[model samples]
Target: MDLDLALVRAFTTTAGTLHFGRAAEELKTSQQALSKRIARLEELLAVRLFVREGGVRLTEAGERFLPAAHEALAAGGRAVAAVSGAGPAVRIDTWGHLYAPMRTVAQAAQALGPVRLEPGPGRDWPSVAQALLHGGTDLGFGRVHPLPGGRDAGLTQRLVRLEPVDAVVGPDHPLAGADALRPADLREYTLWCPAELTRLDFLRRFADAFGIARRQDGPNLGLDHLVQHLRGDAGCFTLFPADAPLPDHAGLRAVPLVEPVPLYAWSLAWRESARHPLLDTLLRGFTETGRAHRWLDYAPRRDWLPDTDHAKLAEGY
Candidate 1:
């Protein structure tokens, strides 16, 4: 028969207690069952392991085996500790549009050690701030918006770039023909928008200025879902980061939102108390990489969109 961990535990406990009754009590088993287990262990080893003299004692052979049994138990403990002692990994959360930044972080982690990238949670500034403040992440990246009173006082924020926001629509939509759309022009069609709570105050201000009221429509959040609806001719229009790649679908087109509020600044943020060396390395890498690529240039002619290349962002870092 194969060796059993339960039998090993029972034998160790019995050896330590030196009394079958006490060992059974500690193990929450009947004395008869505990005796049977010890007997089975002895039979498996083909040796006399214990003797009941006055109370209970290890036999000559059992005395020699006791240390080996303890060594086996210690080995099991070390195995468990080895698995658990690897330390917790760093977590960074970001919106889906910041795939380039995510790739950069991933490359940095690979060169360093284990790390986790959490994505698609923070759709606006408040959500991003809350994620950092609540220990949900070690760092966060997203477009900047008007900070709530007292929010900026406790955190460190860096404006990385000014990204333009554009209205994305399906090819067959009437406004798809326009080279550029003013906020007033958007009121003529139904605007597919994320829920107000998930949207930043600046985006809400832009919508209000453009006279586009929130519509009660199917699937009120999620860019991918909104794009799917647009593809089906659902009379839907949603805003996207100009630096984000246009969905490869033939049915979609992105037109500039010709208002002053159509532009947003991207920022990387962390709590003031966060002082990890890796965090500093990642920040430096991101800043240097962004500068080298001229990612801050938001000119219409610039083609700096997020892509799936880690080596490209890690070029100078």
Candidate 2:
């Protein structure tokens, strides 16, 4: 009869603990199942592995064979790991308020050594697309507008994640305590945005889409400076990605939008001709995580806008 690894593992486990109950618990199986496996192992090997009495005890034969069983399990694990190791390092760039999604990209890069996660150098998608073309970054995660008039580009975009929109209200905002809000709910209140990012068409599109006209503007402090405005009687707010790594300020809150939730996507952007061995591993990690952690929990998939000046952004977000 062939030597059964499962039965051997069970026999060794029971022999080590000298208790079928304890061994079954360690193996995540029933005590009865453990007994069957140990019995089968002993039958195949033609030797009694343990003795059952008032208390369980390993037999002389079991003690002699214990080391071999442990070694067998270790060898199997090593073989699997060796066959699955990643080849080369992948350079990754993380950009925008899209943090939660790009986490998968970082994780994928960990397998490939020398992983670099930097906020890419670019104010918008077109600039980001330029970095890829210049041949410094292997992959970029940010917004990108397709060339106008169906023009050609060297980079490819893959929608990998959805970032749900949320309200970033200050301490004194009237709707701070509301359980949830809609974009139109902010129509009466003043919406604030930084001066530098004003060029992003999505900001204007979002305001116009909801018919909110009383918008205010702030300084170009930084993309991460939105947290500063949420305090000390600011009386205003701006839209934020619900899953972004927002600051834990006492006065700020990212309340979810409802009824007609608006969302933007985070896509993976890579150079068309760029080839690297570890690329597949990074992409596979991005794809698997994207499938499970989408922004829309209730729906099968989130809607992505066209790759336009006001409509671009992505997964591998």
Candidate 3:
């Protein structure tokens, strides 16, 4: 029996996402084409792979075949790279380019020197993890607290930065002129966020732990829009990583949140089975930079983190 690598790729990608449209997007193909490929693969294997009843799901065969599918695709990639005399460039993806994660990557890339790193489409954990699993992306930088897959998700991650969070307030805010503020100082003011209060783990936890009375979520138009909204609302403030670049606004001020400060965890993630010559260089770059800047300084007594993040950090993940 012969296996078509393309069909296998389609299968693996679809298996990773369990959604035809998303799988097609990852493969850069139309949904119809992707469905055809999957049908063909099932025909060739003489067994049904997907149960497309109400929603896309794997049949028993597909669940059993997923691991082998990944292995076969990886072998094919290695074969192509071996003969081509040039491996594919490592693709890295992230969200919020203005944040500390991008800064960490930029400095790491400088240390990497010659290995080409291309930008990938994944912006967060689920997308990034899918990309890593299906060969769309080689590496991703973001918070992995609520990991996309379980502990055995065939992925590896290391804590790269423990960035402190700050309160972004309008100039008229009471604490705007202060050098730093204790978490307790924010209890009286409304905590405004771009997304739903429940969706923001760090902010939600901070608000809960500090007994903040009111919180609100509004449209997340963009940084400029958020800045403007925040500028106009002097009684409300939002939290941002201290390193995130704020748009220049005389009416806006980013004051440090201290006295058991809130911290955002940043980690670099990649596939466990991944192999690249420059992987070591990438890790070393982050390690050296982290060592030089004390990026991972997490004092439990003087800081607050989400429960999941705290567990991971406590375990030295």
Residue runs of model 1 more than 4 Å from their true location after superposition? 1-89, 96-127, 146-153, 213-224, 232-235, 258-261, 298-317
Name the better of 2 and 3 by lDDT: 3
Writing each residue's lDDT as its tens digit, candidate 2 over 52-126 gives: 988888678877666456555545544664587622334556565423445545544455444334444444566
RMSD of candidate 3 to the truth, in angstroms, is: 3.7
Candidate 3 residue spans exceeding 4 A from truth: 12-35, 52-60, 63-71, 95-100, 121-123, 126-137, 146-155, 218-220, 271-278, 299-302, 310-317
The residue pairs that clash in candidate 1, if any, are none
Q: What local distance difference test score does each model get? A: 0.63, 0.63, 0.77
Considering TM-score, which of the candidate structures 1 and 3 is the better prediction for this target? 3
CA lDDT, candidate 2, residue 28:
100
Name the weakest run of 10 consecutive residues (lDDT summed) in model 2.
Answer: 295-304
**Which candidate number would show the highest lDDT if scored against the true structure?**
3
Over all chains combined, what TM-score does candidate 2 have? 0.59
lDDT tens string, model 3, 98-146? 3546676777677666667776545446767766665556678877756
Kindly report which residue stretches of model 2 are placed more than 4 angstroms away from their true locations once superposed: 1-87, 97-104, 107-121, 147-152, 195-198, 232-234, 295-317
Residue 13 lDDT (model 2): 75
Model 3 misses residue 126 by how many Å? 4.7
At residue 118, candidate 2 shows an lDDT of: 45
Candidate 1 lDDT, 1-317, residue by residue in tens:
56776788788788767899999999999999999999899989999888887878888887777645654554554466459985334456676442244544443344444433445455556766765664445677765444658765556666555556788888788888888877677776776655543454445555665677754344344556666777776477877777666557546888886644355555677777643335666666666666665655544333322221112223322
Candidates ranked by TM-score: 3, 2, 1
